[model samples]
Target chain A: MELVVVSVLGADRVGIVAGIASVLARHNANIVDISQTVVRDIFSMIMVVDISKADVDISQLRRELEEEGKRLGVMVGVFHIDVFKYMQRI
Target chain B: MRFDPREIGEVLEMLVFRELDIRAVTLSVNTLPAIRPNLKDALDALSHLLEPYARRLRPAAEKVASKLGVRIVTVRLAVSPTSIMLEPLGDAKAAVEIAAFLDELAGRHGVDMVGGFSAFVHGGVSRGAAALIEGLAEALNSTERVAGFLNAASTMTGINLEAVRRAARIVLSLKPHAAARFAVTANLPEDVPFMPGAYHGLGQPDAVVNIAVSGPGVIEAVVRSLPDADVRTLHDAIKRAAFKITRLGELVGREVAKELGVAFGAVDLSVAPSPKVGDSVAAVLEAMGLPRVGAPGSVFALALFTDAVKKGGAMAASTIGGLSGAFIPVSEDAVMSQAAAEGAITLDGLKAMAAVCNTGLDMVGIPADVGPDVVAAIIADVMALAVHLDKPLGVRLIPVPGARPGDIYDLGGLYGRVAVVDASRYSKIPLVARPGTAPPGVERLKKG
Candidate 1:
């Protein structure tokens, strides 16, 4: 299955996770794993999802997350897992 | 194995916060095939051979850098030295033409600078070497992208005092802004960085991909976080930090080399700093509790820092080569420049630092009216250390014509702003002290 990492970072706010999940559900993406933390009062989250059965492609999902993130006052990004894998291989 | 979120977070922190990067990705393209008797034929051969390679390098470099989230400071191309070409070409004009052509090719290919406008003249001055040295002034003045040097001293060859004098005279006479693009080295390496000294040495492949990794800011961050740590703890922290930093270079460098279809060369293990704030190597010293660089124990700090980095980088890179030590460029590193401005770092102190670091007297400025003999004296001092100790050393002296000590010369971008240093009371060596036999390194090279 094709996997992607989606991240959101900003100050603490309400409904950020639900709002992100709402978009993923509409696109038929399976949220395989999720992790969140608050460091120095900044909210950072990372979600790994299976994109094999998604209705929309990664680019479109990234655009949607970016638009939604702007409205929610958060910074959002999407990336392939290969980059992280290369670093963690040792 | 399943990946962890913390691993991703750690990389993101280094990329976003620490500003880790690959400083330079140099592509060495062979121009030995282009050396010829006729000037036009040589130029034609070079353009034909180099055009396609140059065209593809920048695009591939940019694509790889962006996709991997690694910022590449510059993409450079090093050619084989042009000194060998000057012999059959008949005149220095061909040398000038070749330099200009290299400049044009670099401009067209979006290569930042084209190195190896160089002469390996340590066997005293040959006819071809003399022609290159004679043409150096005009060629550097005429071409923006061309960088040149003369390796006139070595551990085996001792020192080429005559050629050294010529290089010194060339600098004092021309005062070419591009003099910063040239250097004189002793015991120079086949592969190295912090140019004007980096050249694709003889017998290396036509095209090789090498990387110079930089992360002075990251080193500073580690030292800062360990405020009260003892020397042992501090050393461990820097090693851990440099291991990660050089790992990024190795991974990305290997990928870049694979994509470009060239041999993967070394990752220069240096924490080269830029003019950007918070990116200075001197800042690392300050973070280690020194009020300023050149203070007491400063050189010791630099030595330990460099040694630890080398140890860590050696562990990480597939093959660690190209100046596996620290870079102490004054103008390029903001903290270094500041120290110079405040008179905390002296020229002599920097000369001492160069002995321990990878390069020598780099980006140092001097008064415009300094005599050639004085320049020769300064180079002589550094070259002596390089030859005696057997290390790669390059002297990039900027002599500001008619300027005096404490005057600042603003060389924008990577070269940065440099304050003219006091080189007034220099030794007067009126004659080239020629010896009966060649230096030690040359004898070994011959026997080998």
Candidate 2:
């Protein structure tokens, strides 16, 4: 299964998680882990989601998250776990 | 799948946020534009120039911090030397105005400290630079977030007695907070990209980038983990850990430079400590079995720490530089602060320690009425050490303007706190009878 990590950050408000999770759920993504924090008005979150079982393309998933991010006034990006690990291994 | 509970616990421990791993990365950018037209223009341009970088620096730093599972504590900025930048201003008051402008900009942008308000007249001094140096004690005393330095000598230009004398006067007039912000140097390297002294030389391009990585806490942690570990084993472990940490810092620094499209100047493994408990260079020394910083074996402890850190960091990165030795700032290091308070360390003792280590007389507190000649004496002693040892040494002596010995001044924030050290009660010793060329082979003393 292809694992991907998604990070989101925006001004603190409600429904941020639900909005992003709805998009992930529609893509048949399985969230293996999630963590978040709110420091005053700034909100940040990270999720490890798996999408190998689904037939959806990674680009499409990215586009969906981007659209949702814009609607919520947040920054959202998806990265392959392998790419993240390689960048960290330096 | 077979799973061991202990292995599961280890994974969970990594995920749990027990410690806040944060590093302060300062980008020393040239801000000569700020002082070009007038104090107002200087302030406006500085604020504007830094606004974009401030916005981007956090996101960029946070991106890297997230990857490393650490936090970016503060994104600080250091500018080109203030004396040269304010040369057109032409007076001490104007220099102070420019310093205030920079201080205001730093406060607005949430920067911890902004450096480079300094003069490098090691050989001779210009009239404008002299006036600025005269006002530095007051400027640093009155302002927060402003740091200063004076480079009194270089390998090319021999030490300037006049500038050194003026620096002594400034230090004597320095208040506690101001004293902590000041650094005096000999043979100041051109490539130092970090604070209180970063300036874009006329020879450099429009802008360049450098990185300073501090992990005294990490070193302390490594040392603490090895209970009953032999000296050789301890040294090897410290070196290996420093190598790994330096490699990680080099990787991040290179990436940042690549993203910014600037030259990667160098990676400084300075082991700089914070005021936070357990993250101090002094604590590292104490861990090595010194009863306190100025204890009998303090010099040996610092020497060993400095040598091992250099050995590891030099091997880890090709271009390693800066004040890369273990920082022994009293206020910044918990153990040092405690030692100073308990009279376990004296000003002379600290100077002795600096002779065998990196920073020279850093964050040391002293009385206000101390003579300029004595302050000059301290600087000269450290200069002699640097010259004799052939390594970089800096004196960040804070002469509290009104406080006397046994008095403690509380300079809040990372500047830390310091107890006043007794000033030497005797007459000053004369080192240089007259200003002349340095003897041949003096430069050879700096090898290593």
lDDT of 2 at B355: 74
Identify the runs in model 1 with alpha carbons over 4 angstroms from their true place. A1-7, A14-32, A39-41, A48-89, B174-176, B431-438, B441-448
The pairs that clash in candidate 1 are B155-B441, B156-B439, B156-B440, B156-B441, B156-B442, B157-B439, B158-B439, B368-B400, B368-B401
lDDT (Cα, tens digit) per residue for candidate 1, span A1-90: 877778889988889999999999999999998999988978999888877899987777888988999988998877656556655566
Q: What lDDT is reached at residue B290 by model 1?
A: 86
DockQ of 1: 0.37
Q: Per-residue CA lDDT of candidate 1, range B1-448, in tens?
A: 4668888777677666676778888888778888878888888899898898889889888777645546888888888888887878657877888889989999988999888888987767766777888888899988888898998887767778777877788777655368779888886666664477677888688888888888888889889999989999999989987888888878778878888899888888887888888788999988998899978778888888988899888888888877788988888888888787777877788888876787688887888677777888788778777876778787888887766777778888888877678874855666545443246654446547
Model 2, runs deviating above 4 Å: A1-90, B1-22, B32-55, B66-68, B191-194, B201-204, B258-261, B401-406, B427-441, B444-448
Give me candidate 1's interface root-mean-square deviation: 3.0
Candidate 2 clashing pairs?
B34-B42, B122-B152, B179-B398, B390-B446
Worst 10 residues of 2 chain B by lDDT: B11-20
